[model samples]
Target: MSRVTILVYKGFQVLDATGPAAAFEIAGHFGAPYSIRLASLEGGRVASSSGIAVETVPLAEALQCELLLIPGADNPLRAARQKELLTAIADAARSGRRVASVCSGAFILAAAGLLEGRRAATHWAAVEALKRLHPRTVVDAESIFVEDRGVWTSAGVVAGIDLALALIGRDHGDELARKVAQKMVVYHRRPGTQPQHSALLDMVTPDNRFAPLLAWARARLSEPLSVERLAKEAALSVRQFTRAFTQATGVAPAKAIERLRVEAARAAIEAGADSLEEVARRTGFGNGDRMRRAFVRITGQPPLVARTGARREPGMRG
Candidate 1:
């Protein structure tokens, strides 16, 4: 059996440790050999940022596990300053054990010198801070998670589940990971390359006037969603619809459509077994070139790079 240890400290995000622990536990029920435990710098109950306390073993005792997980906190910089904790993490990685962090826990890993010159992911809000603090590390601001060599890092909160699913898939098989994910009721596992933010959510607020229209546009991405078509669907003149949409969502109708198309295309590129041309066609980009341009504009990378980063290992689950 592979022993998995999650290291925690005061103020750690509760989900970062528990979510992955749940995923690993469920995978065990599916016949994967995993033994899970929670550990802290000193054995006892550690209070989380949410005011919930969890019992833990001493970190030194748990350091020899097959996998070590570091959970982020509300203010990870404070945790990163724990010299002994950082030393333990650095020693574990140097011994060739797989190590991973969830959310701002990447800051701790970076502090331990584990993420230097490696691609890592953290909570979006902490991306710039991480980059500024650890200039040698490559911070991927958008990925749900990132695995470079034996080190892994995930974005904020529930993304720890996605990171766990990926690790389970790597250790066992994609089928087992999928079953575990189904048991957990997540997306099967969102690809690590999938952006943490959604274009639809970014574009519309809860009570925005055009929420329904945006949802409709998303459902019919293959259809020609011109400003006139959207205006007609909304039963407003093109001028009024354009003005209201810009005011409500802060972007022009055409730009919004392009963002939606890029978002859909990106999902298809990362998870679907479709060619770039087919994904472009299905998402209303018409061709790869147009899709590429939109992807660069919206995602800051081309579809090919996204696909390569997402599927770096063949048969790897999301």
Candidate 2:
């Protein structure tokens, strides 16, 4: 069996640790070889940011695991200052064990010197802060998760589960990973290259009036979402629909459609879709040039750049 250790510290995000642990544990139930344990710098009950306490063994006893996962805390920079913790993490990586982090937990790895000159992913909101703090580390704001050499990093919250699924797929097989996802009722393992944010979610507030209309548009991206059609779908005059959508989403109707289209196109590109022209045609962009322009305008990068970055191999060093 492969031992998996999750290291936690005070004020850590609870789900960042538990979500991946549950995925591994579920995979184990289906005949996958995984043994999980929670650990901390010292043995005892450690309280998470949410005030839920988890029992943990001392880090020393958990250091020999095949995979070591560090969970993000509400104030990760505070945890990053723990000298003994940093030393232990550095020593573990030097010993050839695979190490991974969830969300701001990447701050801990970077502090331990494991992420220098490596591509890493963290919560989109923290991307600028991570870049400023660790100039040597390549911070990928778009990807849901990233694996550089033997070290992995994932975006905020539920993304830890995605990272764990990827690891399970790598260790066992895609079929086992799919089974695990089915048992958990999540989409069958979103690729590591998948974008962390969704345009639909970003644009719609919980109580937005146009939420249903936006959802309808998202489900039919290939269909022309002209203002007239959306107005008719929402059962409002074209002028009223345009005004209301702009008020609810803070973007004009046309801009919202473009954002949604670009998001879909980017997802397809990163997921290894066959051709940009096909992706554009499928996502309502009509052609590759139009899609490329929209991509650059909204994402500050062309679709080709996204495809290339998604396919880039990890460096030799961990």
Candidate 3:
């Protein structure tokens, strides 16, 4: 059995550690042969950022760690400054053990100098800080995870499961990974190459003053969504709505409409839409070619590829 060690520290995100651990544990039930450990610097009960406590073994006695997984914590910038933690991480990587990080755990990897001059990923909220702090490291803000030179980094909390699933695939095979994902009730495991969920979802201002108009537009995606229509919905003139909506949402009215349409189209496709035409028409793309172009621009894949999650057929284009 491969020894898997999850490094935990004070303020660690509960899901960041447990998510990957559960993935491995479930895979083990299918004969994948993984032995898991949760280890902390002090090696006792560690309190998570969420105020839950979990026990850990001492790092020194963890033994022949084949895979080291680090999870992000609240105030991870502060956690990354621990000299002993950085030393242990550097030592493990130096010994050729596989190293990986989940979410802001990339901060620890960066701090340990494992990610220098390599492409890395972190939670979207922490991307700017990671880039600013580790200028030599290339940060892929749009990816769910990244693997470069055997060091893996995943974006955000849930992406940890994807990283772990990918690792399972690497160690065993795609079949085992898919089975493990299904056991975990994750039906579709997104590849690291796929983009993270839309930035449009996060572009809204904190107060969400434009949410009413956005919700209305989402519900009426099949209707023509001109700026004039959106302005009327918001009870403002076109110019006023344009300026205010941009300020409130950081996206133009028309662009936001297309994004909503794309989101609806993607949902329909993934939910087993029978044809591209129906998806396009329902999502307001009006034609498959137009929807295909929008999907390409938004998700780096055509609608058919996104729907089937594979290569496009020769005659699939409409």
Using TM-score, give the best candidate's number: 1
Candidate order by lDDT, decreasing, is 1, 2, 3
Write model 1 residue lDDT over 1-119, tens digit each, in one string.
Answer: 99999999999999999999999999989999789989999989999999999999999889879899999998988889999999999999999999999999999999999999999
Clashing pairs in 2: none
User: In candidate 2, what are the lDDT values of residues 69-140, reduced to their tens digit?
Assistant: 999987899989999999999998999999999999999999999999999999999999999999999999
Task: State residue 158's C-alpha deviation in candidate 3, in Å.
Answer: 1.7
Candidate 2 Cα outliers beyond 4 Å, as residue runs: 202-212, 220-224, 233-236, 239-255, 258-318
Clash counts per candidate, in order, are 0, 0, 0
RMSD in angstroms, candidate 2? 4.2
Q: Which candidate, 2 or 3, has the higher TM-score?
A: 2
Structural similarity to truth (TM-score) of each candidate: 0.86, 0.81, 0.79
lDDT of 2: 0.89
Lowest lDDT block of 10, candidate 2: 309-318
Residue by residue across 1-318, what tens digits does model 3's lDDT show?
Answer: 989999899999999999999999998899988899999887999999989999999987774789999999868877688898899998998999999999999999999999999999999889999999999999998888888888999999999998998888788877788789888988444657456765446667446888767877888888788899889988999999999988888778887888888877876775446889988998899999999999888778787766664212111221
Q: Candidate 1's error at 15, in angstroms?
A: 0.9
